[model samples]
Target: MPVISPNTNYIRPSPYRSAAPPRSPGPTPEEPLPQPPPVVLDDSKESTHEPCWALDAIRYSTIVGAFSLTSADLKLLKKVPRGDYEDDDHHDRRITRTQSQILSRHGQRIDFGFGSSGRLKHRGMPMYALANAPEQELYRNMSSGGTAVMKPFSLRQIRVRFLWPLPRGEEPSHEAYDEWVRVDPLYTRVQLAMAVARVFYRFVEANRLYLSQYHDYPWRLRPDVFYRVWLLGLERVDTNVFVADLKYVKDYPNE
Candidate 1:
């Protein structure tokens, strides 16, 4: 090789040299990178602003036991003829006397009346007392001296789905949806327990005709029986669907 001149420019690649491009400067003041929106964790504000789908159903149930009275009870009661005071006065008097006797036996002072529609109505009791009277009276009437001990119905594990009615042309945000997904199961469990208790009491009222025929045994809903009501569920299926897993135990003392 000819002698290289001292002034000759030569280039050589080094194995350790990186081939990557130079990094650009960080975000400038004029055109900064987009920062994520701030996350809010105010539960009270969130709850206050939360949609009413869940609350609406709960309020409806509390004000009226379930949505409507049991159809079985309604059908049975409707079969009775409407009262014509001149014709049915004796029958109404007999019914009122029987009701007074029953209330006296149970130590309850509330009076019962036949309305113009011929429906049985409580004259001097609160709405809740009337709603709960049947079951309570059944137990009182059955027990000897009202001192008999009966085992309460046992509730097993309850599994429920988180569902809420979506308003027309409205949708839940990701945060709200996630919150509901987290809390709905718990809320449903509590409401279901309350509903089950309410239904247990109402069962006596709804099935009074059938129960009255059984005089040998205690006239109450069988402790081991499984009673279900669609309205007792937290929300209507059209709005929210739920499943209540119930298991009854045979623990009532045999007479």
Candidate 2:
């Protein structure tokens, strides 16, 4: 055995140092990997973000009913990020990004941490966390309603789980505070997607037309034109003239 000196430097081999020669390539092309069909989960695998079909019918009916009761033309409200805690009493506390990422919702938040640490790490317990329960309008973790609307259900918990909570302490607009818990962005977006699917299923079930008859038709040709606009499932959006004509409704009271 050679005695190695403590001060001697050792040279590391190059990463690709194998001395073997490359083999000749085969002429045939490789087969492409197959893609999987999309999955739609049922209630057994439901998450807090989703409402069941029966529940959705009841809830959506209530909301639509409430809108109908307004004698004057109701200007539909615009959705904005509401996951902020300072604006509402839902979030238990003001939370760090890591903590809020756990529950993955856009609503009046609890500022509760979601991950394994299961704590309100930096900001301490949110004021809402100490509250016995949230206000009636504020939704808790439940997807029981969508079931009634006959909506398409996809597994979104995985995506939602890692999503960060809304930024705390947004600018106070009197208009913003009044509707704090009315229309949550994430839930509305998801609900809209379901509404679109429901129309398609209705068309098929009613035998108004075969899917092949309108397979290539634009989604515009579908039933209940308004529901198509539900649950955009995205944030920080702008609508240009090319997108959709802006109809100015009398400015909403909150605005």
Candidate 3:
């Protein structure tokens, strides 16, 4: 081989010269980095937010039973009226939109993330992770003369745990464990109505109703309806109209 001078400017030729030009590197900072769209989570699988009318639903149900429910409530429990959705210019667009969404997903399997009896999975979590238990009431044990404390069997327990502590001093004699555990009929009835409202909402959500439809439904899933209205950016004017018009009874505090 001929001796090559180290000072020569000869460059080694690349075999890829005949190949296609290399791809451009990613966009530079000056080019705004071609920002990707923000990630949006699909809340269609679960309820985006609990309803706003839950307390009112409970309060009213306790007083008048089925009479407390509204036309929308009945529709949710049974079937949506043809006129409710047929009108494009319906006064309440929220309802119309919700109905449209439900119709769009006429057939699909829905997983509510909980069992049919409304019990949530414990998965080794503390009871606090579960839904809050309902308030306990005192029931008079006519024979024992000692008042029995009881509460509704809530779907919110982490396990089959009794939240209420048994009486310390006097244990009322009963033929069965459930005898003293018997809850107020009115309370149980209201709780069942609340359960119905929840199931119905899940049905609507499974059918692809807008996640925002949580508020549009007649019943509120959480107690803070007004707060949710603000958080969801829903107009108070519309929400005001959605409020159930049952006369308030001072005796039954909206507790």
Candidate 4:
């Protein structure tokens, strides 16, 4: 697996814009609630998978077999298709095509660029459906013209930037410190997620096992630029692996 490349200077370039438009004068303009970081995992903390009779009893196939094997499996089972003979131009074109397709997909939220400090600035899709009549009215017009829903996709680096609690000169400024302590655990969980994602990217880049294939990794376009790309669970699906596999979940839910 191409893991996170060691070159810290290598910043991922943004792709298209997010599918969801920014919420302006809407969505309460409240800062997202802050959370904690994640606990690091080491070999000693890990455990073996439980024996599953289900694995033996069930015949799992993709929705009609997306592949006889996964890409990871291909990395092992098949020969690394000798590419020394292939022309670089031919391979480059194929990669570009794959990235273009991901960007053009209907519900994809592409991240176009970052702010001066490297913050993901714009989203590409329909604006959040504001309930304020005026704001909602604007969304309705955009939707009529076939606007995108919430950001369609996310980027690998984009993180969630929470709203700052107090203005720089607010009175009783230290009060929030007490509250911050209580939420330390949540912040830890989020950081753990970012750390794993950081590792995963290197695996992808180093081994050159690309999901994007050509363009940059298809991370979600959330508020933060270096955050996870997929939604955790806005809703539940019967067979989604994240829902089915508890261990893969990176959440530290706030009460």
Candidate 5:
């Protein structure tokens, strides 16, 4: 029985003792991170600054006729400087308020018919030509004694002055004062010239109807002729920068 038991005593191996597979080597140390390119700052020299007040004046004059300008008109025409005004002590606001008051006054004056008074007076020139044709010698046969000497009608001259006030209580060396003094006149003149041109054009248009009534009166209604005459007179006048001699012509008829 002992021999039989020994023959049957064989041992079984455990299944839970299996070995693990090896892992891949960790990634080789990554190449050092690439450095970024250096940034370059510009160190160029700045150009010299030039004063703009005079340049602005010349520009204003070329586009707009040289004429007397109001404070409000000048303010409208001025090229306002660019900058932050939050810390400007409200000077810009004060000036704007003052300009508004002046504009209000101007509008009030216009409402009282003062704006068109001169225009109306000038518009009556055609009627004047009709009444005083013989005395004024406006036509070839127009004369007190039936003279036939050909002559043209005289056009009324409109002269506009360029007037603006310089700054007071400020030294000439101050930039603000210099700008105010130079820019104000320039802007005023430009605005005034525009205003004059508008008025003159309106006057011509209105007189066109009356001037057409007298077709036999030698002088015909020609806006181009009137404009040319005006330009000629303006160039001749030294005191007035804006002058127009609006005359009727015999060559052209109203369209």
Candidate 6:
């Protein structure tokens, strides 16, 4: 099966705007949060299901290590068709859709743009829903209204962006450091939401497989049956611990 293309420049282009929106009043306006460097996964290995599974195993291990999830939390995740994580275009679409949903929510809008240093600059909202909302809420919003085949590499890269704390700003001023500190929690929320969305997306896709087994001949699965199966997968997650991980993430030292 095709895996994510070898090209590693996976960051989606910043959302387009006619002109910069007016800044809303909030805590001392934060300098744009520092951006993470591009992730370059080694694609030298022969393209095969084994290599894909290896990468996916690493991702699952990383997720289990970072959060308070049991192996059982991913019961549904394991069911997703392994081949779905190979399309580059699908990855782009999902990322774009996710960004649009977050930015459109009722709150101060953020415009991500390249700085002179060629890094992402988060400008506009001091406290946006992406940073402030509960991870589960964000996940629910993000997971719905979209269907895209996501690749492991793309998913891994996106998670890394949110998983770790942002780098310190260049300015020596305390304000910059304060801004990083404030923005860290926001990332924590987004990180979990994005993870949830990833898993949810897989469950949605897995519906195709689940429905197929019921009949030897191809038939359109009823919407009710389709939704129920997908939702069942979600219901299996331990949301309490999932949310508690928010606090855990805050205290967890950033390496």
lDDT of 5 at 209: 45
The clash count of every prediction, one per candidate, is 0, 29, 5, 60, 3, 1
lDDT of 4 by residue, 1-255 (tens): 001223344333222221113432212224443322232223443446623321211101111111222333222211111112133321211112233444354432212111122111121111111111132333332212222222233211222211111112333211110011111222222232222233333322322321233232121111211111221111111111011000010111110
Candidate 3 to truth, TM: 0.17
Please estimate how well model 2 matches the true structure, expressed as its whole-model Cα lDDT. Answer: 0.23
lDDT of 1 at 85: 19
Model 3: residue 124 alpha-carbon error in angstroms: 35
Please give, for residues 1-255, the per-residue lDDT of candidate 2 as tens digits. Answer: 111112123232122221112341211223221121122334455455533433322222232222222324222322222233344433333223443345344432212211122211111111111121122321222122222221122212111111112223312211110000111224442232232233222222232122113443222122221211222122211110001111111122222
Can you write out model 1's per-residue Cα lDDT over 222-243, one digit (the tens) per residue?
3212221112122111112122
Query: By TM-score, is 1 or 2 better?
Result: 1
> What lDDT tens digits, residue by residue, belong to model 5 across residues 1-255?
000011133222122211111232312334321221222333364536523432333222221211232333233322112111233231221122233244342111100001123222121122122221232232321112222111111112223321111122322211110000111122222222233344343333334443344454323333222222221111112211222322222331111
What is the TM-score of each predicted model, taking all chains together? Answer: 0.18, 0.16, 0.17, 0.17, 0.21, 0.21
Model 6 lDDT per residue over 92-196, tens place: 111222333443422212121112221112111111223333546434443231223221112211211111111123121101000111122224334533333
lDDT of each: 0.24, 0.23, 0.21, 0.21, 0.24, 0.24
Q: How many Å off is the CA of 109 in candidate 1? A: 42
The per-residue C-alpha lDDT of model 4 at residue 158 equals 28
**Which residue pairs collide in model 6, if any?**
85-151
Off by over 4 Å in 5: 1-184, 187-193, 222-230, 233-243, 247-249, 252-255
Steric clash pairs (candidate 3)? 51-220, 51-221, 52-220, 53-220, 54-220
Off by over 4 Å in 6: 1-28, 52-55, 58-179, 183-255
Local error of candidate 2 at residue 111 (angstroms): 27
lDDT of 6 at 138: 39
